[model samples]
Target chain A: MSVTLDQARKIIRQTMAKGEDMKLKPLSVVVLDAGGHVVAFERSDDASPGRFGIAHGKAYGAVMLGMAGTAQMKRAEDQAYFMAAVNGVFGGHVVPVPGGVLLRNAAGKVVGAVGVTGDSSDNDATAAMAGIEAAALVGEI
Target chain B: MSVTLDQARKIIRQTMAKGEDMKLKPLSVVVLDAGGHVVAFERSDDASPGRFGIAHGKAYGAVMLGMAGTAQMKRAEDQAYFMAAVNGVFGGHVVPVPGGVLLRNAAGKVVGAVGVTGDSSDNDATAAMAGIEAAALVGEI
Candidate 1:
């Protein structure tokens, strides 16, 4: 389904709830539509002030590459210059981290993505996955 | 209320819906928190790709100056050097135009700002006002 505001809010809610249930730190979450545009975002009360930017960067990176954040990170692993160039061109909107997960529709079409931050990379990924599942979408991260 | 993700999304939705209803050109919109950081943003399907940066710049300018984009433009009038200084210091993240509006909370505190770009500056300002109203926030523009 096309990413709607309701869907975006649902994903954010689910992700933050998962963080709470797992006793993870307060998190920042962001949802982006297929066009690499933000649909929704939230930085929890206890989340670091900088979490919002990092969350958006990760989600934007995932959407731009059409892959998981980790995959992008791996691709940029040996190319520091490439990563730097991306950041320079995009105004620091690329964060190749495990917190970003691509979302797919039932037909396996990439619909959008979710990005989470404020915890360990693995925990952020797990929170994002929980959000994708809660929205009844496939998580590819 | 604080500018939550839901509020930001609502503002964007209302702004774009107004654009559609008015038969205006596609627009790019951005929302920034009180600290002058992006909270959410969108580029309409038909919007020019470059509009994203411009929209963000306008919003950032409004938030940083605690005034409307037009006001900022007026303040910089006849002072090209000042405008250049601002651009240099902020890395060109300021667009003093009519599209940006400062959002205020119930207590009259600046909460965030919204920026729209696509049509004429006046039309952009109208769209931003629509969004702020829809979000139940004060609009200073």
Candidate 2:
């Protein structure tokens, strides 16, 4: 399942549009390819300056590890050494939270991921999912 | 001023090389384009996955706010509410610390920034600066 940059950009645009339509505060959105490279990104004008990277990092983490960011945080709860090692290794890219979602093709192959920030993790996840669905990509709850 | 993807990748590679030469532990490096969007990034295989996000966040915060992450940390002390607001707005992307450096062009225009983690904040800053220098870009110390 190859994810195109155009699709990623479309997801981001639609997501941002929904956020605006809902009057959600400024948000940051990111899309990653299957290989974990960034495909597209944006930080809303109202979004805090660094929100873009946070969103991207979380999304990148989810895709690379093949798990939710929140799951990683859960794992960190009982494993300081693991957490520290993660901190040491990834240079801080893996953010364990619930704001990211994996994208799958119709064949159920993981194609990419989307991450959103500037809201609760749940809300961020919701927005990302909405975007993915709008793009006709399969996303898991 | 624009920071090219090639320059960003170069920064990460050189920074990682310096870390290896100095016998530092595995490192994660991130480069942010103007407006604080990630332009390019690479995570060492041995580096912890979390380092990727943390490094990017810290660096994004530094450049987005036009100050060193450490300086922001210092200011946050007196402006807890503002800092909290930043955190909320950024959705966990901002890390006020010393591990990131702002990148500038010849005209003193901030074109991008670099962030490194997996060691002391000072060490991270050193690596980030080295990468910036290697790119022939001026770094705001």
Clashes of each: 0, 21
Candidate 2 off by > 4 Å? A1-141, B78-81
Error of 2 at B21 (Å): 1.3
Query: Candidate 2's residue-wise lDDT over A1-141, tens digit each?
Result: 546655776688787777777667777787777778665566664456578668877887788788776676677787867866875777788777777788899999988888888887777777777788789898753
> Over the stretch B83-102, how does candidate 1's per-residue lDDT look in tens digits?
87988888888998889888
Q: Of the true interface contacts, what fraction does each candidate have?
A: 0.20, 0.07
Top TM-score: which candidate number? 1
- Return the interface RMSD of the candidates, in order shown, one decimal each: 4.0, 7.2
- Which tens-of-lDDT digit does each residue in A1-141 have in candidate 1? 456656777788899999999999989888888887766677776566688678878888888878788888887887878878978888888998899889898899888888899999889999888888888888888
True contacts kept of 1: 0.20
For residues B1-141, could you state the per-residue lDDT of candidate 2 as single tens digits? 667766875787799888888788878777887887766555665565466678888888877788877788787898878877887888878888887788889898888778888888888888778888889998764
CA displacement after TM-score superposition, residue B123 of candidate 2 (Å): 0.4
TM-score of 1: 0.77
